[model samples]
Target: MYLPGPVYDVVSVDIGGQVLAPEQYRVDAAGRLVRVGGGCWPDCQDMAAASGEPDTFTVVYRVGLPVDQAAVAAVSELTCHLLKGCGGSGSCGCKANRNIVRYSRQGVDLEMPDPQIIYSQGRTGLSLVDLWLMTVNPHRLDSPSRVYSPDFRYPRVQQWP
Candidate 1:
């Protein structure tokens, strides 16, 4: 079955409280969990039962793209920006101005882009953070998309469970 990923690892798979061996299934390049052995996934599961209980199916996995140097740098930049003036004496010069759209003093004017506008466009005002966000999710998708085919027999998952 399709699992939302760039799946890094499969921790465990349980069917009816019994753990499946790694040999029984494999994660394909497309992140599909394919049954490798003769057995098949159950067509139906008990909705009321907790995961790992009898008649329930569960798969525990880790999902995300591997963190690289660019990601680390971006996070570091954002963290430094956030902590700039959080805890220190009054003389500390660093200040985070998240909400100032316009400033005027002695006939000189300074205008900053609206923070609301930036947020609406799925961008942070911070350069590194916005750059990283744009690079990773240019379209600003909230979640991965999925397609369903009538011909395909999808495993039944209990909605409430």
Candidate 2:
């Protein structure tokens, strides 16, 4: 079975008829990696057929949130902007001014950006971040889709009934 998402750690792996050692593979934030063109076959194989033999290419790994550096940078930039606009230590008393009529506070007129427009337009006021997300995560799906079969039945604990 091909495991998806960012694999952080790999517990074990079996390929061909031999079990791979810890030194054979390395797990990183991005994914798991093994020696190229290593194992039973001449070339590295991602998947293998099921066999009654000892060699069953199987892998055990822990999948985690696939957050990349670009995403982190994007979130950080948005957070910084909010903190700068509104005081982080305490409220600056500058509420959102969404009204069309200009409002003045301390001789400075300000108008709050329309939240409805931003939401409807799917914009975060950050062009670069929006572009990155649009390219990297357009649908915003957290994980890959898994196929489910309704015909598959699970074992029942009640045998007498």
Candidate 3:
């Protein structure tokens, strides 16, 4: 699942979201594929339970704004990203998804989709960040909190959107 380079133009990185770079993957002592962090791959389990308010959650983004500077400038919307089950306590059941497929990449046009990700946790105002630059405050998504890839390859873009 490892891509050679970084995946850009991201919107939202939610629990069970997909697409990641090689460096994001986590391996074990045996060099086994473990987990992928950064970017919203919603399948992360750690984001499952209520870490904050009920019915509201915060989302982050690691964007590569080579194109469409407008969207990059006005960074107040939901874009495609994922979490891979980081806090589920041990559940391997949800599919990785895009928060807002059309708004994530180039050319596709539509209102910035709001990923209505209702975890057992809750919801609140959304938080989008330029994760590529800021490296001070890091948070985990709601699924696949644990990184242990059955396959040796790292996480990659699902090519769905």
Q: What do the candidate models score in CA lDDT, each in turn? A: 0.78, 0.59, 0.38
Candidate 2 yields a Cα-based lDDT of: 0.59
In model 1, how large is the Cα lDDT of residue 138? 87
- Cα lDDT tens digits, model 3, 1-161, are 23222344234333333434445544332223334454433343444555343333334434232445444533533232223234453232234343544543476565533445432223322344344212222344445356776787865434212
Mark the 10 consecutive residues where model 1 has the least summed lDDT.
89-98
| Model 3 misplaced regions, further than 4 Å | 1-3, 7-71, 74-146, 149-157
- Taking the tens digit of each residue's C-alpha lDDT, what string does model 2 give over 40-142? 3224443455632344566767666557788888888777767866874434323544455457889899765666786676667676678776778688666
Which ranges of candidate 1 are over 4 A from the true structure? 85-161
lDDT of 1 by residue, 1-161 (tens): 77885777788889999999877887776577877668898889999999989999998988876688888989998777657656564233345465677889999998888767978998867788889988988889999789989899866432111
Q: Choose the strongest candidate by lDDT.
A: 1
Residue ranges of candidate 2 with Cα displaced over 4 Å: 4-11, 14-19, 22-59, 64-68, 77-101, 126-128, 134-161
Pairs clashing within candidate 1: none
- Which scores higher on TM-score, 2 or 3? 2
